[model samples]
Target: MGKTLAEKVWDEHVVRSTEGEPDLLFIDLHLIHEGTSPQAFDGLRLAGRKVRRPDLTLATEDHNVPTLDWDKPIADPVSKTQVDTLRKNAAEFGVRLHPLGDIEQGIVHVVGPQLGLTQPGMTIVCGDSHTSTHGAFGSIAFGIGTSEVEHVLATQTLPQAKPKTMAVTVNGSLPEGVTAKDLVLTLIAHTGTGGGQGYIVEYRGQAIRELSMEGRMTVCNMSIEWGAKAGMIAPDETTFAYIEGKPEAPKGADWDAAVEHWRTLVTDDDATFDKEIVLDASTMTPFVTWGTNPGQGVALGANVPSPEDFSDPSDKLACENALDYMGLEAGQPMRSVKVDTVFVGSCTNGRIEDLRLAAEIIKGHKVAEGTRLLVVPGSVRVRLQAMEEGLDQVFIEAGAEWRGAGCSMCLGMNPDTLQPQERSASTSNRNFEGRQGKGGRTHLVSVPVAAATAVRGTLSSPADLVPAGV
Candidate 1:
């Protein structure tokens, strides 16, 4: 009968509740991007309504901005128009805007946490599906549609039917080469793409507790890919430490008080979930998606699944379609699968920790012939920090192109895209057909795998780069 973390956060944010109708939940923070805010802003104009709480709203240019040129006019007219409209709208609406070239400008999800705007026990919504990234702090964060965007902008609240809760307990220690990315991919493979439908998953247990805040963010970031409304991990010491000195975080006496409250934002001992599942992290291996969807993945050493491997007719057909589109075959080995590019950045894996991991593996090595490597930071702050620590030089010297911060090569919304049929190993979340570019093939990977793949010109891992033994 106890409350789960999601339930607790939801109940606290309810502005109004009515029987047989959705509750109007107060939105603590609203994140907007160029891709989804244009229409919402127009809606506000038509209604002659102003943003109800401009202080609680923020906007950034990511989806449509070019990552390479900081000052050049966006070449694509559609992309340029979108970016321009957001700036004009933000200014007119009095919402804080982080345009390209601003130190804070980056992926909305990345900007939120980097600035300490994402906190525990608060409700956050964005137009991007990866908004669940903020739930790493035990917040009730999820993506909203364009209409909902306008609703939140006008009222600072959202109407919602509460989702069922699911507890995903990851126990045991991860192996040396495994990472949060691998863990999440493995989870998707186990649960299938629709496993978390109509639920907000709360990741728990020993292994989840042991991950860093960055690692936890990576997990929660991909919750949507598995059909979950949101994903979260309870706030703990690690979460507090990460937020301690952040620019938007509380300071001095306020910091202490905030932590005291965040500490209480956990599931009660007897809290019951609509469903529960357990995963043993120690048994996991480096994982990658072979098919178009995230769930069609196997371990790094496993073979591509044949269509017949699926017992269900629909699953079998889906497998066949994915294999054809991916230009892969049944029983094909995942290791050494050739790639044209290796992209090391995204909301899911574009933070400083992710950059450093890729840099460490890429140091003293060069990208393989005919393979292009791109190291894009998640935010301008992360980019500056990476440069301060000389991570840029490490990547540049290793033949990786060091670029400005943005959601490059993540969704192919900008110039950072793949040529037709070009294959890539990327750290981004989705890998659906044409997700990276028209006719492009993407294999979702971790930083280590992405870096190693660049050097070997194939889907690989750190262990593949290292000699069998010293």
Candidate 2:
């Protein structure tokens, strides 16, 4: 049997295997954040152990830092303490630290790729669930718990049972108005939330091959929501191009050698997967989640699903509960559903390219009356790039609030959150119940879809709002 891309990468990273026990795998990189690293650092201290490979570890303050007022003290004491502790720990452990407002500071996942720390055939672990975002580079990246973080700090390796492999082959080109976000949401709707359980998915086929590195990142970023241990696309020309000039990427002769190795990272012609799924991209449209879970999605032009449509009693009950919490009517057109807010930022779609796409659509369009819109950058570097391109002006002129870089409103960990009963069209991943805030309804959509929703104050697609040329 031929090995899939996941299997190839896993086999290469395995350090040792014992019968009836999990294999000990070497982790190439360990990413840390303020939200989860505090206790792990403390554990290492109490155990009198030093980080085994400080050079391979990195830290940043994101989840708890305020987006505004970079120079001021963090207003929330708990948040301040966490951020402070991370800095102290990083210094004590001899790991590189990107503190709040630092040019390199941002969401850990975003920072990894932007800095070229995420590369093909490597094993990356972070404390954030969206660590799968790094898998876009053809690496095996996944989230780890606090204890696991401590373990990695002390050992620079992880013990793991091998996961099954699944292939999500997206064929054909996507429609004009569809996006990576829509494609992922559509897949979730088809496979349900638990479809990829105990599996590391390898996205393949023509459509997957056509995606940009950022687009691939967006697709893999939500794999956890589908219950996948990790999700990845094989390295190709596009991946190489994106990493070519990155600071940490190989240069000169080393660059040529690295690309040569990355070239062979693709699945072989006869590679076999444990499971396979095929999706047609052309038929997909702008999609949104109407319920708490990421799987409860429908096309923008479609109607909300009724619980009775589900044949399984469990599915029916789940749909009913989701509908009740979302306050959405069954069979009601999603386009006509009003929104209270629009948020455009997160590891899933908070890059410079994402902001540019939304800004292009929002150039002359105004946010609907009474709608609160926020445009946050994923990191300080992304924010600087967006400003240089005047994306901030375009958003501010369109009546959207432009804020600093951080994981804002994505998990409600910061002050940026929705008020009770406030419904929002957000570009961030995850639409779990009260994810944005207590009693806050969330509808996950693409950047363009989010831009159009802000213009119309309802769930909408950019094609419906913008003209043919302008």
Candidate 3:
């Protein structure tokens, strides 16, 4: 049988294989952040071992670093220590570091692709769950634990069990007002959280191809939430275009040669996946997570689901618990739910395209009286580009706070956090209890939806802002 994309990539990168033993796969790149690298660096120090390939490694201070007042000392001592330790380790290990205030500094996943470091057919790993974001480039990228990070640093390779392949082909075109985020949320709702367990999912078909690179990244970024080991899309013309002029992209003859190789990185015509599923994007609509998990989502026009709607005991209990924590009742229109804050930034949807789209949606409209809106770019370069296009002014004029690039409001690690029992419509992924702060409630949304929610002070779609019969 012809090999699937995952099998092909895995075969090419296998360094050693032994019966009853995991295959040792080569790692093309290792991304680091303050939250997970400390212990990995510590392991190296204790072993008196140097990084096997410093050129293949990149480190940055994200997660726990303040997105605002970045120049000032970190007010939280623990956060300061983590950032400082990474700096010291990078210097000692001879790995390049992108500290705060550097144009390259941002979320590790965002920083990788912006610099053209992430490429097709490469094996990338980071000590962060969202590392799957890099898989949009057609690479086998996934998150690793701290111990695994240390292993990659010491050997430039990882021992991994080959994963089965699943094809998630989204056919047809996405309808107007729907987005990549909505599509992903829909996939999760259909497949449930554990649908892709032990498999690498390849998103394809007409709808996937129609999306821009940023949109593709947004789709792959949440693959982990679906319990996939990794998510990928085959390299195509759009992929080549996005990486063409990046800072680290190959130039002249090398560029042509690279593209030629990338073109071959697709599943064979006759290749069969271990599992396959298809979705129709034409029927999709703007979607939101009414409950805590990504799977607990419905169309914006739908009502919050009741526990009784589920037949499984575990599922019913989970729905009940989520409703209790979210302080929502069954049968309530999702659009009727109000919010205290709205955030538009994260590895999932903090690229330049996202910022521009959100800015356009909120232009000339003021944030609702009881709502707080924060527009944070994913990387310093994204921030600078947004500024060049005057997206900052549009957001500022809309009564939103424009902040520097970082993983702000994505987690409780940084200073940007939700107050107790405060609910927010956020573009960031993950809405687990206390994910943003203690007793906080988070509703995952697309950037445009988030912008519209800010203006309406409720769960809303951009179309909601339009006049009747306009």
Model 2 misplaced regions, further than 4 Å: 466-470
Off by over 4 Å in 3: 466-470
Predicted structure 2, TM vs. truth: 0.98
> What do the candidate models score in CA lDDT, each in turn?
0.93, 0.91, 0.93
Q: Where does candidate 1 stray beyond 4 Å?
A: 467-470
Consecutive 10-residue window with the lowest summed lDDT within model 2? 461-470
| Deviation from native of the Cα of residue 383 in model 3, angstroms | 0.3
What residue pairs are clashing in model 1? none
lDDT of 2 by residue, 1-470 (tens): 66788888899988999999899999999999999888998999998999999999988888977877867999988888898888888888899999986899998888989998888989999988899998898999999999999999999999999999899999999878678898999999998999989999999888888888889999999999898999999999899889989889989999888888888788877988889999999889899998999988988899999998999999999999999998989999999899999999999999988999999988888999988789989998999999999999999988999998899899888898888889999999988888899989999999999999999898888877865236
Error of 2 at 217 (Å): 0.2
Clashing pairs in 3: none
Q: Kindly list the per-residue Cα lDDT of model 3 for residues 1-470, writing each as its tens digit.
A: 78887888888899999999999999999999989999999999999999999999999887988978999999999999999999999999999999998889998989999999999999999999899999899999999999999999999999999899999999999998789999999999998889989999999999999999999999999999989999999999999999999999999999999999888899999999989999999999998998889889999899999999999999999999999999999999999999999999999999999999998889888899999998889999999999999999999998999998889899969989999889999998899988999889999998889999999999999888964234
Clash totals for all candidate models:
0, 0, 0
Per-residue lDDT, model 3, residue 89, is 95
